[model samples]
Target chain A: MDLHLSERHLRFRDELRAWLEKNVVRPWREELRDPTASEDSLIELRRAWQKKLHAGGYLGLDWPKEWGGRGATAVEKSIFEAELVRADAPPILNFLGLSLLGPALIHHGSEEQRRRFIPPMLSADEIWCQGFSEPGAGSDLASLKTAARLEGDEFVVNGQKVWTTYGPWADWIFVLARTDAKNRYGGISFILVELRTPGVTVRPLRQITGESEFGEVFFEDARVPRANLVGQIGEGWKIAMTVLAYERGATALAYSTRYSRDLAALAHACREVGRTGPAVREKLARLVVENEVMRANGVRMLANLADGKIPGPEASMEKLFWSEFDKRFRDTAIDLLGPGGLLLRSCSEARPEVDWAREFLWSRAETIFSGSSEVQRNILAKRALSLPQEG
Target chain B: MRFELSDDQRLLRDSARDFLAAEFPLEETQRVVEHDPRGFDPAAWARLGEMGYLGLTLPAEVGGQQLGAVELAIVLEEMGRACVPGPYLDVALAAALLAAAGGRERLLAEIASGKAIVTIARQDAAFAGEAPCGIETANGKLRGRKYFVPFAAEAQALLVTTPGGVYRTDAPFAVTPLPTLDPTQRFARVDFDHVAERMAAADVVAGLEPLAAAAAAAMLLGVMSRAFEITLDYVKTRQAFGRPIGSFQALQHRLADALLRVESTRSAVYRAAWCLDNADPDAALAAASAKAYAGDAARLVCGESIQMHGGIGFTWELGLHFFLKRAKTLESHYGSTEVQLERALAAAGL
Candidate 1:
């Protein structure tokens, strides 16, 4: 089987690589290492990066061209991401909007909603946070208690959404709120609520990494226009499930690229410290092997996507692999580098190439946030294997 | 880009699977492993050669099909799934080495047509920390011992490795069988003190290492996959606590993790095979990574398969131990996991 990129996709990748090399003035690690960079300033830098990518016509790649997409395929999209990682470019600021909400709206929203939301979302003028997980319902997302009752011209919302990524900085939240309290899955409605709505509140939640990259959103009778509903009522669960699957296509390529960079940095760091013992070397080598295997898996996925195959529920296998490998890689990095590896990026003695301590802590969230490892395993068992569900 | 077998490769795989299931089923393999001195049926090997499997990766000019490594991996993977017993991989690798050396046309044709059996003997000792390849050739005579030579008793000749070159020495040399954990394997320590023709320089078979590792890893991919399927079937039917044990979340999650390992190994094995066939720049590193990862993944999947099967899993009658033993043997040989890790590290320049 051919794994080589087609000439057309190769051209797309080469052009994107050249563009990234020319445009990325400061790599993301350098930005992170900047002692003076605050959270807000970093976000603004990300917003500017998104604007640059949008202008380069690299955003919404794989979406229909009518909505500012590049009319590219998944192969191009995967290459774009891999190039972004290889160049160490800042992540696009509005990923939630671009990856999750944009797909949801494009597929299920009213034409009026798309007209109002799609442009600003692409331009980073309006950032969106997913309002799926809540304090009471996470792995069991359909159990969400968020309620939105339709009034004359608005839906009055009341619920607290926790682990709302980008909640602290986003202008909007696309929520899965219950419209029919009695039906578990069908009763839910997908509603987009403005943070500026009268009773909405956003409070940053301090993560173990000591950053509020995500936060909790409170909806105390927040009045969102009824016109903002994405699709017919009671169709939110179906839309959310479909949107989550969109996030899975060829992501392993991006993860492998990012991890390979860090792994190389870690290896260099080990050499600098003269930790040449066999034990440390073996650990480093194992990480290298695992990372390369991950890359193989990613390449396989990319090729399958290019072959026009839709990934099935076994996509959870990819999620399980990369997320679990992140934990192992980070843990080994810390163990190999010793105490110095635990220093925060801002610390004077910390390694400049990577914030090892922050990464070690952040990797904990990788498996937890995008469907916890346990949840993914359950999905594989029930869907991919067709094993009998718990009695 | 497609990450699947081509139509021809799929046909080869289907034929190999069908052939193995019919000719060398597990029951037959059990008998061979139990009573045969050679550890494999000679008749079955002849059939494999007749099927053009013995020369799968050799050149068409040498009486081979001129298939690529991916196709070889497909056949070996099916061989692994069937738990087919033989020195099939050993003989193919030996023939490849001979073909690479460039002076053995008649012997290569004999190998491709099932008229000869030969395997490379390189290891100087059975355990680690020993100096590799104590064997040396002086003039036309080869001397010294090689450990863990597969099917040395049955091999028509041995491609003996020296510090200076590789020599193809005829059999009737000293050979002692060294039975290990896997009864289906035929390994021996061969003492060489015979007049031997130095076929190629020491580095002539260097490229074969990656091919050997990747092929072994392909077989491991097959072994572990079959084990996973067997375990999945067992969990579905075997009841405990008034319900099917597969319904248990504890078992299901572990099975899910096993599936992840198995699928990841598939990706790594085929990618390595593809890289080698195309002579890609990443070929060495990919093959090493595939071997290292597949070894560990196979051990996990096979062990967990036995664990989930409970009592019957440990029984010899159930035949699960064959897979578990095969996995261990595969892991410890063909550039053992530790050696492959180092190779991967060196290839990556880490």
Candidate 2:
């Protein structure tokens, strides 16, 4: 089977590259790297950048034009991501809403919900956070104890969502709450709530990276309009599943592209340093091969998704490999850099503060955040290997 | 772009599965492993020949089916599933090498008819120096010792790789059987002492190295896939804690990972095979990655399959040992994981 892109796709890629080169500038890059940048500044910059993308018809390229998208093919989407990484543009702050929740709402949400949410998401008028993981329910998400009770025309929600990235800045949150507690999966419902609602509190949690990029969102008697409920009653579990599929499915593209670029840069830097020995070179080569494998796997996954394949449990393999590889690659970069790699972003002597050190620290959560590597291994064992299940 | 198997490939797989099941069942394999010249049934080889599998991927002009690598891979996978006791991989690789070398019309014809057993001898322990330590060629005479040559005792023609080039020998070369981890795929140590033979090609050594590695990778894919299926079947029916173990999340996740590894390696091996067939520039890299990934995956899955099966898996009577042995042997056959990694790195220009 041919792995090369078609002529038309190549042309499209060139066009996208040209566009990104012209549009994506150093200001956006500078804004993203500014660790002490105010949350409002980051939010404003993200909104402005997203608005520019929308105006340029790049945002929501995979969605229908009627829904404020260019309706581009998956290949085009991959090209866009690759070019975006190459351009070193600002990171998308509304990834949860744009990639995961927005897609789920498009598929499972009511017509009104779609009309209300999709446009705002595309325009960056609204930012969203996922309310899936809880204290006791991370990988075992169905065991979530969040509750939402129907009351007249609204639902009173009360629950705590931990590890909610950018929760403090989100304008809305799509939550999976237990509406019918008798059945685990069947009892759940997906609903959207405005973050400005009364009794809703968001407390930013300090991470090991010393950044408050994520937060704990607590809802106490918070009211959500009944119209915000996605799909049928007690169908939140299905909606959540759909969102998770999108999340896991989209992972191969974004993660691989970013890491591939990072890997290339790291290799260049190591060569420039000229102090890396044969062992370091061998380690670097291994990471390169792993990166290539991940890229191939990612391309295959994307092709399968484009062909309407659900990817099912195989996504776990991609997740496991990508996260683990990220950590290892970053660690290898650090080791190769030696003392120079230890320099923090705030340190003047730090060898290009944005190089391997920041990456090493950031990669700490790669496995832990997106369902720990342990959980991923469990998925691979049970779903892929068909092994005898442990009691 | 098209990864799906063709109709011919599908039929090849089905027919291979049916033939192996009927002719070379596990009982027959056990018998062959216990008391055959090379631990493979001759009758089974004849049956495979009669079914046109011997020359499944050879050209029609060469007295063969002329199918593609995908079809060959399908058949190989079935053989793996059955844990079929034969020298299929060795013969197939020899045929491919002969085809690439371009002057072996007679041998190819004989192999297509399943009348000849051939294997490539390329594994040299000493990889450095002007010439490898295992095999040497000087003035058309080949000498040196070849280690762990699969089915070497039973091979009618030995395809020996030397620093000078690849040479084919039908004459009596010293062959000593070596006790191997996987008896089903028997091995032997051979000492070629100035054996007179025709040098196949000047660049045959360089050209055939990757092909042999790719074939070994494909064979391992077959083994791992079958082992996974067997493990899955056992896990499904074998009860633990009052329910089928397959129902448990822990086992399911592990099995899923195994399936992913197997499937990914399957894809990689097939891609490598395709690269060989098409003579793609990326053939070497693809072959290296395929071998490296498949070797690791096979070892891991095989070990886990035994662990998941509990006591029965570790027993010889249960037959899990057969595949485990084969997996371990295959991992070190073409190239060790470390060697493959080095090759992969060089191929990637790292």
Give the winner by lDDT: 1
Q: In model 1, how large is the Cα lDDT of residue B28?
A: 83
What is the lDDT for B26 in model 2? 74
TM-score of 1: 0.99
lDDT, model 2: 0.77
| DockQ, each predicted model | 0.89, 0.31
Q: Residue B89 of model 1: what lDDT? A: 82
Which predicted model would earn the best TM-score? 1
lDDT of each residue in A1-391, candidate 1, tens digit only: 9989999999998899899989999999999888899999999999999999999998998788988897788778888888899999998999989999999989999888899999999999999998999999998988999999999999999999999888999999999999998999999999999999999999999999999988999999888889999889999999998987876775859988898889889999999999988899899889989888889989999999988887886578888988999999999999999999999888899988889999999999999988899999999999888898876
Error of 1 at A358 (Å): 0.0
Measured with C-alpha atoms, the lDDT of residue A228 in candidate 1 is 91
